[model samples]
Target chain A: MNSNWHEEAYYTIRTYEIDSKKQATLPALVKLMHESAMQHVIKLGVSVWDLEPHHISWVLMRQQLSVHRLPRLGEQIKIETYPSGYERLFTYRDYKVYDAAGELIAHSSSTWVLMDTVQRSLARFPGFILEMLQLAPAPELCLPRPAGQLPKMEKTDHSLDFVVRWHDLDYNDHLNNMYYLQWMLEALPDELLNHGRLRAFDIQYRAEAQWKDQVRAEVQHLPNGRMLHRLVRPDDGKELALALSEWE
Target chain B: MNSNWHEEAYYTIRTYEIDSKKQATLPALVKLMHESAMQHVIKLGVSVWDLEPHHISWVLMRQQLSVHRLPRLGEQIKIETYPSGYERLFTYRDYKVYDAAGELIAHSSSTWVLMDTVQRSLARFPGFILEMLQLAPAPELCLPRPAGQLPKMEKTDHSLDFVVRWHDLDYNDHLNNMYYLQWMLEALPDELLNHGRLRAFDIQYRAEAQWKDQVRAEVQHLPNGRMLHRLVRPDDGKELALALSEWE
Candidate 1:
């Protein structure tokens, strides 16, 4: 909140954003964090529009989120996001969510890579964007690393097939990352999803799916009481995302 | 916007709310109107929280909407909703969406009935709410009537079964109405969906679907290039909603 590199945004939990318990859903927090990221880049003059001429766009690769407790309906929440640093090809961003009472509710760390829209492959960092995200090196070392390669699923307990619809696409015309998580959550049992709660989650993206694409979401029960998930394209058999989630 | 009976709220298009063209989606407009209606009742001290103790809740019966144009992403728009009037069993509400320049972009009319949560049936209007929604009767005559009985489907061209997930439910513990519209949109052919555009719609709710229910969304192509839509529970075959849509 003190520096030009950090951007802060405020949001109120809408009725639709809550669950049956009247607490804000994890998807709501993800949207807020992403919105804050967009706001930060727009202010830094490196937004999608600014990079579009060069056919460059940001593609999310990995994300980790932990929730102390979900905020209740009508609660005013503040989101702060800033770049942690950039490695060879990935930029690190961290997010913090606080309630109106100034208590931390949730926090997240994400990794994104520059993509050449025309080539559909990772692109080198744009010098201008690198210059704007000047985070000190020491802090990046303390941040939790983005979810790395996930373990192979031993067996799939639940799986669902989803054909990407127009509503699943975002302004970027690509399926929003949030839908992947929602599909993962949907594969969970009603006893767990309705009765249990998501305590933490880690996800790593492997590919992108578009409208009308048939993608299969699979969930495996891990040995340690966690759930491992994957979104895979049925036609090409390409993995779209790999994830691990903890339930309370 | 001029009177206490009228509630106005402003919204900015979000990245997740727009289609590939960067124009706001119909579901986005629906959320805005509902949010504005919530704001209106909150101001009148008759919000859901206040009525919960009485085991009563508002249930949408019918809605009609027309769009002049969908707002672009990041564009600021204003939504105004007010109670148009109320008959013995139904309360009427109207919504208008305007862009920053004050040009009308979308308008809607809706009818709602009160439900007794304990009894699971229609309930008489509460005395307090009846006093707040006082509109002069003359203007009510000019407003378009809420969508009445819809023509039965001749034959379903496309159908999709959607198992209501935890994310699909709202604070009311019932499936959000927006999801019904989304499922209907999903049932349309990609040839019509990806290329064609929705210009207007009228929907009437027949029953409420809760979590874990498998509802089938079916759409039939009409002879006049329109579409007839229905959301029905596969168990009891209860019609959840009947809708008609006109596309550009």
Candidate 2:
């Protein structure tokens, strides 16, 4: 087996993956980052198919992505990912996206947890799984780990209520992470989304949202020009996700 | 160039494309069919890129899909498409999807109209465009042209109001055809969606739906075990689209 831990994958930005600005959407970029991570693990022989028999699966805990520029439609880009390191009850991974010219376009870091699918509880990492990954030496990341707790703002400048639809649910029976970013950005003023570009964003998932849940997205424009977003279930007042976005 | 008008393309169903039943969603299938048709037109040297300089584009007017079975996740399927014919103010195309075993899974037919993007009106088809296509003899299709007018049912058994979101808008600056199906099926009773599979469906686009438009989908259960759906804008009382769905 190769000692090198990093794996690379290439993707073409499809028209459907782009937004009205003709730039790739945040959800599309996140999907590429996720597929890259999956390919990396599959290269290590630890794919979801490999773990299914053990009744174990990997669940994303938190992710932070910083973009230099979003790719445009029909642009071919490369994604490089590697297992960074492990912390208590969480595994770390890092991703970097590059344009055709090898210029860095985006960088992201994510934390994942192993879960027992049947019991719906956190599961301890198996030694064999760790052995297969052969985690690379920790490298400095462009962005720091997402903050555990975001500061509460005085007032929400914009808010919208969204019903979790069938299309929002993934195979895991929970709302996909991309929708969190969608709802967050959707709540922003049209002037911002239409004119500006997303430069940096981080999301911390606190709880799983299921189908038919009414999610309320609230956003506050901070004094620093950053946007703070919170997605909560109105029924139980459960916070589903929190995010901070910076635009250029 | 060879005179053969038919074209074939292959697609691998991705995990994200499937629903709870592990089968491909209607939108994914429609996307594949649309992509296949685009590729076919491009091969004939009349792609959107080719038409952009002329400020002209092709817009879907109507489509009917009949499914023998929905493809499953990770399944490789073949899509065959060809220009069937051109009638008064409309060009017709047909598509067939086959599973790995070469068994027909679904078949679809669509009608399109040329649009003058700058004028926002239908344009008369140019003779050169027809010359480029070299339309083959019309092939027998599994489904006929979608009815111009769906019957107005007496009462709506289920109804839901949906606001057009940013994600719902495609490059055309209108609601994607797939979302029309999604919202229509979404309004159906859970018993129909969960216990039955969509066998045949047809939709006719009457008007474009813009972002933030408050559209209501009303569905009625026909005595023949079919569901009739109509989407209309409450503000102007204009019908956006009409659909009829058969479940097995």
Candidate 3:
């Protein structure tokens, strides 16, 4: 897909954006995607004024991102985004990341929905939405599949439980989505988390948890050298999330 | 507002939960809240069995909370949350926070919206949602006023424009929300933020910002000894956020 409807912006890499590992953190990437999306929307002239009096806000439902090469400390990166059009209820966008010389480092696709703030309903795409999107035809968004699915929930046997801590919260008072991926990986033994590399994984958020809640995480190793993970509440046996991870 | 509900849960504060200022960090609070809410939902019968197939997720829309007194490091806080009924579009929940000795520390109100994960649409309340949430009687949610609007955007009237650094980014790519508050407080003349006592104020998240994005923050002294702060993207002249801060 191709169209003239495209714009490019540049951002500098800052020291604070890097984590203890000295790499840009995944949460930072999530934040970047959000800001970039907003910038794209603003370029389309859909400011807060474009929404109805009732408040219109963007809510992240689910995201699947892949990082082939992470930018190093003090390295500058350029991120480009294009509207890939919409699926039934979601507007799809694709992103291509490059280093200073334009070497491809990552590619991603995200689905977004417009919401009615007051009625708390899914808002239909206003004509201005297209206008706000300033749609430009772009290459189809092709994201790499994370590792395949592990067996059913019963297959994963060993499990761990943790109490929700005050620091685990976000502005919304829920576990930040990216934080869960960390927990999903952290549940693995130190040998796996420390030496093993995260080849790929798929995580599905099942329910929201709050402070002081007890959460249970279960893990299993497959003969194929992959691990299956699940998080739940042991007291009532509530499953919070599930993921299939492969590491070396 | 008073509550007759006998809800009780103890949250053990962790060291990571404390910010540079030695206070419970707000992002951590958000994570705990997510766990708490999920536990509540599970108890209401919305289990993994009911959640699969349809990927559904909830994101915070808006929240109003007041902190009377923040807990010291390692303090175990008890937080009680009860449904406060629904407003125009949000499922409202109210929280009562207590210190180890049972002294009230803060009261907060939060609003949330559910979304269809794959479709990324504003998903209406599932049939079981109201039933599940309504298990507890509606309690009073004392709403807080918006923090004083940040003073009008100016050329930093003696301020600094910071390009967000990597370290500043959390798992979420955009600058951490708490950092904004911290930045606002930091921009204040050392005379203020360095004070020993923390009084009260309410802040709201208007939008997310990116790294290397130049932020211009302006601080003005309000007539009542409070401060008005505005953070703006100078390159595009867009207001990223605003805050009204008061201190003792």
With candidate 3 superimposed using the best TM-score fit, by how many Å does residue B141's alpha carbon deviate from the native? 48
What ranges in model 1 sit over 4 Å off?
Answer: A1-3, A135-142, A147-149, A223-225, B1-3, B135-142, B147-149, B223-225
lDDT per residue (tens digit) for residues B1-248 in model 2: 45657789888777677776778888788888887876678678776667888889888888889999889876899999887777677888889999999999999988889999899998887776887545655446434655566677678899988999887887666887778888888888977766678898988888889989999999999967899998989999998888898987
lDDT tens digits, residues B167-230, model 3?
Answer: 4554335675556665555566754643434454445555567855777666777666666777
Q: Least lDDT summed over 10 consecutive residues: which range in candidate 3 chain B?
A: B140-149
Which candidate leads the pack in DockQ?
Answer: 1
Which residue pairs of candidate 1 clash? Answer: none
Per-model TM values vs. the true structure = 0.93, 0.91, 0.44
Best by TM-score: 1
Q: Using lDDT as the measure, which candidate wins? A: 1
Root-mean-square deviation per candidate: 2.5, 2.7, 24.9
TM-score for candidate 2, please give it: 0.91
Of the true interface contacts, what fraction does each candidate have?
Answer: 0.84, 0.45, 0.04
lDDT of 2 at A91: 81
Q: What is the docking quality class of candidate 2?
A: medium
